[model samples]
Target chain A: MIDNTLNRRQFLKSSVGVAAVAVAPGILLYGMANGSSEGASAKVRWGMLIDTSHCAEGCNDCVTACNKENGLSGGVAATDSQWIRKIEIKEIAGGRQLSLPMMCQHCENPPCVDVCPTTASFKRADGIVLVDKHRCIGCRYCMMACPYKARSFVHEALHDQNPDVPRGKGTVESCTMCVHRVDQGLQPACADACANKAILFGNLNDPDSEIAKKIRTVASVQVRADLRLNPGVRYQGL
Target chain B: MYIHSAVLFRNRLFYALVALAGIVVLAGLYSVHLMEEHGHIITGMNNQIVWGIPHVFAIFLIVAASGVLNVSSIGSVFNKHAYKARAPLAGLLSIAMLGGGLTVLMLDLGRPDRLLVAATNFNPTSVFAWNIVLYSGMFGAVAVYLWTMMEGRMKPWSKPAGFFVFIWRFILTTGTGVIFSFLVARQAYGTAILPPMFIVISFAWGLAVFHIVQSAIYAWTNKVLDDYVQKRMKNLLGVFVIAALYFVVAYHLTNLYFARQSDFERFILSDGGIYPMLLWAGYVLIGNVLPLALIYLPGFGKSYHVNLASVLIILGGFSLLYVFIIGGQAFPLSIFPGFEVKSTFGDGAISLYYPSAPEILLGLGGVAVAFLITAVGIRMLDFVPHEDTKKFH
Candidate 1:
């Protein structure tokens, strides 16, 4: 009342204070709602633990789920692309036979990422390995470098692809651990589809996570550990 | 009148050869078009056997291209009058073969249209990326080197240029070897000796190519390569062939010493069907032994014999590469060291590959391209070697 006619400095300060108060809640809510929109976080390392004892032989539920979810042709021809394959392995000396699903090991030091000529093969901050098809020149040097033979070059054109996953001919591709679902706070297709609950998916870096607890307690191993690749995927039984 | 007619006949024959090469190049282009439309499924390459006959042709052209320049290096760098006379031709062949080899490599890509992407998006960790730089640098370096030799004003720069080329080719060949040696997972590669082996192999393959081309040129011009020069070159070729064989044997011996690699060594040398056959019959016997006999045997040192030896060496080079590149891939990766793995994806089994018609045509196209380039270059310029009679005497 005493200073009804305000000065320019006083008016400017009042406007800034009003704007901050009005915008703070909206900004906070946006941050809270769209955590993944900021891009993958380095703090989280996604991983999988598979128990081969629980995995049933002649059952390919994980492979089927992956093929459907990823919109694969499900053909087993030499030229056909198979993201996840059911491998039946027998110990040469022991003669112990077991069937397990094999896919990209998602290594800490991925040879595919290292040998990619165009830097198209990359590892996400959240420990997901992916091929940026836009930059892929289809040279297939990554395929040659991969230790696990996890990569497959698209030999022919594709049609009716999953809207979530865009793939094309000539470019190389491999398992993504269903990156789209992981961002939405859901398990991978294979993990969800495992009828016997053999597959466990969680954050490896999070000490309290189930996968982390299991890995710490049980005997889990990475395939080809001698390569010193430190793969995120772990197996529970031989 | 007779001289005029003879000149006219030569011109006709040259034009016919050019037309033939042009047709082959066009056929190759058509095959590339088909591959682009349908994809690599049309070819023999698959998930397991990713590289096929096209790689063999491309790698051969590339390796030999670098080797062919050895002639110029001997002349320009070492100051050998006889070799210097042949330098121009050597330089010309090097450029032609490189052009041909790179063409096949680029065209065989899954996304050939994305060549610009490979050039722009550089990954320093990759040997493939390094190869792009090395290959392009070679073209530029050799071009400058050639100019220095041909242009009178640029003569002074030739020595430095030759020296640079000599070092560059070594690095270039090393880079090629590193492409395989860096594969840590593959049983057939990941050894340090591969680099030296490739270098020695290049010496023999490159000289063999030079001999064939030089002989063809001499025959067309109705000129005789002096007996002394021919003997010296043939002897050099013999030494190179022996050296190459030595390195190859050493490579196998080293691999045999390793326990893990024994399975792969066995597969290539004895067990693997076509691979063993190609290595023994195609490479060792036909490519090496017969060629050696033709060149060094008491009675068989004729010019035709030398040419025949050169041809056999080239054939042997192809056979060795097939075993190296294709056979290397045919053997499965040992993912589970102590386990026998079976999958729908051809795991734990030998992968089969049969090169299709289009694949062969595409490879042949590369050879045609090199031929066309050489024919055009020689016809346009004085690339034919002319030795001074007095010097040899």
Candidate 2:
């Protein structure tokens, strides 16, 4: 009797696992086909160039813009969901003090992507680190693995979600490079909102592009360059 | 038969509690929905302290749960027949811990709906991904072991599986340590203490959880937890507490001795105020010192005080984990050329955060689920023992 029960349990477990695999993909494909291809316009390898020289000390337009576009929360409280941040980097003693506009570095080798127990957080073929919200199990291992603290966890129920970049509680979120808007050939809300042009959006791979030219003609460094994530985003002295 | 049915009817209390937890979880699911739709606004977490109470609690519970299983596996694998009787319980507890821990994680997320994304598209590079695999394997083993035992299928092959679980548990704990260890930008870099720290946490949590559950069950059954068992567990906890304290002292001393930057870091233990409070109040007082006193004292030993100490130590160990993850994250390294740059996540700068009601309720639901699973297994299986009590015990 016990053996029969054990066999039945095993059979049940296997069948459930199999049935899940069989049915899940059909639903996922249907969803992704509806969503992942939302941007049918020119596919751009979105990158950032934070010009520390002109940042208005604490004008959080870029932060708020990303939040507004991506549907994030902002406040005086140190927010867990920082799609962007402005950090003051002083030059040692008496030189220039610069404020950095920090966002996801979107590394070529994102540590967060590296340590995920599941492939929920993955780098798209186009070098974008995207979380397949459908597959994310809320483990937050990616949050820990992310050196930049770039990821944020939704700790509570937030239903008034933005349609463009929809996110829910219990999953990790970061600057998506506006996967939604960028699909339509639109620039990120942060770059679009930066009146000072303190932020630049372009393709890092495009040598003919202004960002690539700036990197070539002048010198810029990525944050924590020593960590060797090869961050796509670059900063001009902060 | 009706009397037996009456006993089963009495279990309705447990069922009612489970149902109550389910309702709370359903309410919490609304909070998850809110977080999913709007963003993480229902809680106090901000950019400064993104990983808050739920993360710490989940991680701590998992390590403790892993340790509970380790105690049983260690004995079984190594021919320590003395511990063999406790193997089933340990196996059961491990599954419970994993379930409880994962549920905490699920609720803590900004998007619990996408949790499956982690598994379907596994990232080999992500430590979190590796943790998923490790947890899957660990839980899979324990669950299988438990199921087999319940079905009276325990065989020679079980020992090898137990041995595998025993070895990998240390690795899993060490890997958990490495998660904190690899943060070079953070002041916790170079402590080389994370692995041992988890080991201590695992022991404290495991023993505490063990005693807590056992004593509770024994209480319900109107049976006294044997004096010998209580004495042994208390002594074991006392020894671990001292060792954990020693590691804390040695770790801090070594840090301060090596790097002056750590002086500012030591503020966590000293000047950081609440961190120190958590240390002295949480880790030292509840986690180590009080438990030590309780174990040594004779009066408390006669009653459920040992069980009570277990609960306290479990809470204390949880607090220490908080100090480690949250407090550790809070202390910014004084790496700026001249002065200490405060951590975005630290005290004063710490964005006030706690587990949202939904988060806690979801955690409770996870516990209920685990208990319900265990109850069902116990009802249908010989692992709960059929007739002969002394044979397995």
Candidate 3:
């Protein structure tokens, strides 16, 4: 009766405080149990599908875009770190020709991860393989173990990195599937740059994703399917 | 004390030899410093051929280290009284060579400073991780074994110590071989025969190293290694070299049998330009056949032929490793099985690798380091086998 004139604003504020106190512990517990931040969920397996049929022979837009995206600018050569490159293929028997981009296959069972002594080479919860630069001893065992010849060792000191991609000398690196972009719900630079729409990037676990649909409906092949690595990268045409 | 007197510690020639070896070790260290400062770009190794000549030297030393311990094992484990006197020398060489090899291996890493990470971050599935434990444990086992032989009161423990190291070295070598064998992706490695093949090669190389050191020590003291001892050691070496050859043949034949692997086989066996030459002329001819002939042929083993054969075997060993490690990478991986591949990344072509001066210097530094260790250790202790050794044999 004495405080009735204190106003509805005060009363509503107290009520809100009481409600938060009652629900905050439960919310905190839920957050603690889940373990990932917003947009960093483990339910997605990021993958790419390269339709070799549509991939133009002379177009280097994807490679250039990847370089710009990843900060692999200078000292490019046969020995330099090339996260992705174009491979021209011709069947020895049939004499049929094709060209495809090759990078890390991001295998379900990667030989690189198995050979890394320091556990530097690891696969993310979302099935993206990466080398932990801090832990990579640069023994280069991963390069030897990779069937697709995917990994490259940084032989020289790096400068002017793209901030997001922290590269250095004496560590092994491969295509990360543009993980920074993926976290922000953006397509990989390579996929985005492909004008012919030959590259499609999406969560392989999602049934509705274009990559999933193509893999199911189309006859696709991994570079070395005999290894049974179950690579995340697939090609539509040989 | 008797052994120590024979070490020739005061000789000008001895000091000169030690100084030369020390200088070589310094040069090697300088090369490593340059590599660390400038990065691996200064070296011959690249993305395609990741492991280069440094590995050749390191592996050779490590393999020989395991073999050197076999001499001690013959005394303590096999109960050969003749070998008992030489146990201390063998143990010392084992430590020295292993230490040198490990130094080269550690220094060659991309992050040599991150050696602590290798110790802390253990991956159970990785053969490389297991090797750290095996190699470390081997050093401990060998040290204790050496102590048992050197200490008068600990003589009773020598056999047990020897037994431990014998088992330990086998496991260690198997672990080393598994480093290659576990690589299922490399067509040149991961064969079933690799572990045993490495074992035999270790024996051949290790015994050869032992003979060379022993001979040098005897010569320094103005004594001759007993004819009986030389003959026995030579015969054992011959058997080991022949066994190694058989493994190589069987390994190639197995690859040849598979239609999918025929190209790889042809590349290594015949068509592979340098590789075929290495296997045939280097490993098969100079390394195996000549050594065998020198050992078994009636008049050959009587002269310096055995010593020459030992040198040939070692040279052949290096060539064999070069062909295996470098040549393996040179042949392109079978990424697109039946398709001819061309890429800026050297996808379909043979990777060319020529080791630079720094690489060779770094490799030789490991050799020099091992020699320095042996020279210093022998002078400090009675590492020369007792003259009683000849009497026992």
lDDT of 1 by residue, B1-393 (tens): 349889999999999999999999999999999999999999999999888999899989989988888899999888888888898898889889888999999899999999999989999999989999999999999989889988999999999999999999999889889988898999988888888888888889989999999999998898999988899899989998999999889988988998988999999999999999999999999889999999999999789999999999999999999999999999999998889989999999999999998989999999999999999999998899978867755
In order of TM-score, best first, we have 1, 3, 2
Which residue pairs collide, candidate 1?
none
lDDT by residue (B166-195, candidate 2, tens digit) is 877877787777777765556555356877
By lDDT, who's the top model here?
Answer: 1
Model 1's TM-score against the true structure: 0.94
Sorting all predicted structures by DockQ, with the top scorer first, yields: 1, 3, 2
Tell me the TM-score of each prediction against the true structure. 0.94, 0.75, 0.92
User: Which candidate, 1 or 3, has the higher lDDT?
Assistant: 1
Where does candidate 3 stray beyond 4 Å?
Answer: A1-40, A74-76, B1-10, B387-393
Give lDDT tens digits, candidate 3, residues B1-393: 346545555476789999999898888889989988889989889988899999999999999999888888888888876677788899999888898899889889988999999999998888989988988898899999989888999989988989999999999999888889987887899787888888889988988888888888887766777666677777888888888888888888899998988888889989989889998899989998888888898778853787788899998999899998999888898888889889889888888888988888888999999999999999899899874654564
Candidate achieving higher DockQ, 1 or 3: 1
User: What TM-score does chain B get in every candidate?
Assistant: 0.98, 0.86, 0.95
10 residues in a row with least lDDT, candidate 2 chain B: B383-392
Residue B376 deviation, candidate 1, in Å? 0.5
